[model samples]
Target: MKTIRQVSMLQFTLMVSAFQISVAFLSLPRELARQAGTDGWIAIFFGWGMATLASAALVKVMKNNPDGTILDLLQRYMGVWASKIAAFIFTAYYLLLAYDGFMIATLVIKLWLLPSTYIYVLVLLLLIPTFQIAQHGFQAIGRYSEIVTLLSIWIPFVYLSTLRHAHWLYLLPVIKEGWLPVLSTIKIMVYPMLGIGLVFFLYPYLVRKDKALRAMVISNTLTCLVYLGITLVCYVYFSPDEIAEYNEPVISIMKSIEFQFIERVEVLFIAFYLFVFSCIWIPSMHLVSMNSAWLLGKGPERGHLALWCFAVAVSFFIYRPSFIDAARVNNFLNLAGFVMEFALPACLLLYVAIIRKVRGEKRS
Candidate 1:
């Protein structure tokens, strides 16, 4: 059957980039600093290489079952009950990811721009765009990702303005924290580079399947460069001690920029950043709905209110974490994300490859 909603190579790549690059923007540099200090960018490269291998494995598994997602492959190889169980677990994972983005974006806004606004109000405001894209399915989400990613070009330039205060000394004494800290940060970095695993859900919808892995590499590479650039800028622009003081060093760096034309450019930056941040939640919400729909042998249409409700219910309990609180939660999520996005996918690829080799031997 012809898939009616196939996404192009560019759109697929952009979607992955958008997802990897979004919510991580404000927190990533800070987290990297917390883990590895100024030597953090090295860890980013390590994480990027790790993500590259994981992405290739994910694409390979998808290539093996071109007509179906991992869920379908599980049913074919494992039992129906097992496949459904895996699907439910994956569905829950994406839902949790969606809510994570939702919570982070809301908290960022409350911290920076809309402190007077209620968390529930921010939740509703955020969900409006998320549901609009998710309900329309991957096509809309793809195009939205493309547009928002294009809009992200301005981010680098904004960060560039802060280089006026650049301190080459702060970034000096490379490996000052030793490789141990840098190595630890690799684990921290892996979680944010995780959006590549969405290939399981998105691969079947790719217009040109042959280019999917190539596009995955390109997306992840671009995201890696974006992280590297942001982290480097933060490392150079802020003192090592001062970097630790700010919760969101990327946004805090912007506060150093003073423009006669604009009163507080950081506020404007964070406000516009809400659009880029939406990239994470919108597509994730779609993944949750699509997984649920596919498991039931149904078309990938919308109206997945149950997942949205689950998100809202989660938000009530996860309400307005302090910087330390959010960091603790983020650390926990990163550990979980590493297991799901990298460890499990690598294992799945090995399992699928072995299954194929045995089948090929049988055929021979």
Candidate 2:
């Protein structure tokens, strides 16, 4: 087996964190309100707490098997037949997520900038460089992630400056629908933290010894806080009616900002958004490529091939014939994503814990 290059713990954390903030920050508030009404932010907090606990369990699984990826550990702990089934399911989920990332980028472009832009051309432009970086391996991707992380922090500051424009009165009458609505929204809120699952595949490749668990926990905690903050800000800024009416509430919030010299803040928002999209797309591409390479039992060259295949497949399949179909499909995919990303990891953690206990008792 050709060894994958090692990345630092900090790099791993930032790569995951930056990607989490990207798509979630742009659209989550709207999704939250649709599901949880006035108590959407509270649902987000609850979801984050659940996601954090699940992530910690996953990290424990990784730490127990220091040099093994989830696939490797699955095969060792379970039978070969069962492991193959699990691996295939996970691999499919990751590929779908990569495609979803591509689709989202194209969707944003079409909705906000150019209605007539070709999805394939946009996907091609984005993927070619991503393939090149994936070929360079994880270290290059990590460095790029670090740079984007610094830029991503500035986004919240920009959003925070728009607070004065937000209607604080909109956030009144908290949790009017009570606990049931808030609990229901957990499913939607937890989907944003799905990037945490990437750690199962990448943790074995980290350079730092025994720190993956701590790093991931800290990273996830910070991401959850950031997401909750952004969602709350949107909830307070826009009326429930206004939030439901807008597709991208954050961008709409930015549009509401104005000054004498700069006529539009949306342009600045788009530039930062492009940076975020890049951060999200590259790591997603990397995960798909690396996992595909592992599955095929091929050398590093196969990683390059995997990257191209993923990029091409997504570009072709993602362009819906109509905008309405695209929106419907995207919403369905987001809901499906909660299952693959959150529910699957939680199940895997449970499996691992059961196996460990069984093994311990047999030994005793």
Candidate 3:
């Protein structure tokens, strides 16, 4: 095993926070509106609560086995064969997640910015840096995440400030329909919270210091606030019907803006979003590399193999002749993600807790 140093808790928190806001800010508002009607933001809050609890449970599991990956701890508690099965399932989930991220980015690029270019080329261009960063190990990834966390804060403020032209009446009659739709929207809203799973793969690397849980909770709370703010702005600025009509509500919201200096805000938004995507892509690539290294028992250098494999596979899978097919794959991956990221962690935590209690009773 490669000797991985523990990183600052601050870095860990920032990475988690940045990852949470990036993907959700892009497509979530429109998706939520589709599922929950006008009360989509309500479902967002509900999902936020659910995600927080999930995050806490994940952290607790990490605490129980400090300096251990979920795979490592599972083996300790659930026997080697069972742990191998669980690890395989979890790895498959993350691979799908990585594919979804790549597909979403490719779709956005093809749809809005670069209609003439090939998608595989774009995926390769992005993946090169992602692979390089992951090879630098956890510290580099943490530092990069800290820098992007600042950008994450600034991007939203820029978007929201431009929203002076927004129409608040679009958000009126909150829940014009019954609450059932809002409840149903919970599943839709929860998809973006997949970033919480980053902690499972990264937590063992965090330098545990005073109040580690506090730092993690604060990070989660700030991330939830950012998501809520973005979702609320999208709801209030564009009517539910308008949001449903647009494929990318954030881009559409930006397009609606015009300044004396700038003719098209979408271009500016895309430039910033590309940066955000890069930040997210790096850490995800790093996770894939780290996991692959552990699985293959080839030391840290093996991370490079995983990185290239992911980059190439993702590029091929996403850059299909039919962009529609790529999108269908992305949606199915997101649905699978909800189970892998949220449901699996919850189950693992419960299993560990029950095992601990049973062992304690046997000891007594």
Candidate 4:
């Protein structure tokens, strides 16, 4: 299993898009509206474009290294001890990301479906599948992302039902608030676009490395479309002034949907969204386990991974985060993630480019 072959580009896209779509489903529209009014979607596309450039830099780094993970590069550039320390830091980072997935899912589930349920139970449910999928390594996780994406494909079509009350006038005069607000919200947009950094670790497993850029662009485009469509639908359906009142704008849109047979479809949607949410954490757990395994100078350890997943989940419930606290934590994560997503990639690519140039000169 440690020596498994590379995944197809389609699987690659699904995996990447799945992570991008996860936590954003709940509060993204609301955050955008709060920050930039209807212009929030614009910032989403802009940040996505920026994320694409950052992603391309990462792909360039991977191509130069070829046959290696970031750890292998660290080993080359620094030494074995330094690489081990870097792997440990990355393991902690992946765990932090995994924790965010669990936190976001728990918060949304608690808000939408079971306000009274114990947070511990929700955390347990979220972590169980994370450990199960992370234990199987990337092969099972890739298939799971693709399969879950197929199953959840109908959700966007379901969102269209809310457009019956859509007021196109709400989106009129798109920049009613001025460009400053929209520019400020680009930071918020970068939050949903956070998954691009995972490509550093994922690129080595690509079946067609040359198609890596296309896979990334397509995946980012798909995620941008999803965010754009939902935000557009939300902007039209609710008055601009009232949109900020709802915390989870995308999920709230489902409230208007009442079928003759189905009383509250949003409940069903929120329940099934756990699958969408899983993509964020499962890959995160894999990264954590794989990085830790590398730190130990071995392959992934499912048992240790399982323990770390549970620890992350359990810590949240033990502390019992309030909604405001969660938001604060997310703000910190957003800042950290923005640096990792763009700045780190730009620096790494430059480093790799210089190293390769120096090596060529030595060979000449």
As a whole number from 0 to 100, the lDDT of residue 285 in candidate 1 is 81
Q: Pick by TM-score: which candidate is best?
A: 4
lDDT of 2 by residue, 1-364 (tens): 3476899988888887877776667788888888877678887667667767777767766766668778787888887766667666766666666666767777788777767877777777777777777667668888888888787677778778878877777877887877898888877765577677777777778998578777777777788888788887888788887788788887888877777889878876775577677766677666666666656656674454565566565656664544465466556756776676667677877777788788883321
| Residue 252, model 4, lDDT | 79
**Model 2: residues with Cα > 4 Å off, grouped in runs:** 299-336, 353-364
Ranking by lDDT: 4, 1, 2, 3
Better of 2 and 3 by lDDT: 2
lDDT tens readout by residue for model 1, 91-140: 87887777777778878889888889877788876777677667877788
TM-score head-to-head 2 vs 4, winner:
4
What CA root-mean-square deviation does each model show from the true structure? 2.4, 2.8, 2.8, 2.0
**Can you write out model 3's per-residue Cα lDDT over 284-339, one digit (the tens) per residue?**
66666655655665666445546555656665765464547655755675687677
Q: Residue 208: error of model 4 in Å? A: 0.6
10 residues in a row with least lDDT, candidate 2: 319-328
Candidate 3 least-lDDT 10 residues: 300-309
What's the lDDT of the predicted structure labeled candidate 3? 0.71
Q: After superposition, how far is residue 282 of candidate 2 from its true place, in Å?
A: 1.8
* Model 2: per-residue Cα lDDT at residue 21: 71
Write candidate 4's Cα lDDT for 18-109 as tens digits: 89888876788899989888877789878788989988888887776667887887788768998899789888777877777787788888
Task: Compute the lDDT for candidate 4.
Answer: 0.83
By lDDT, the better pick of 1 and 2 is 1
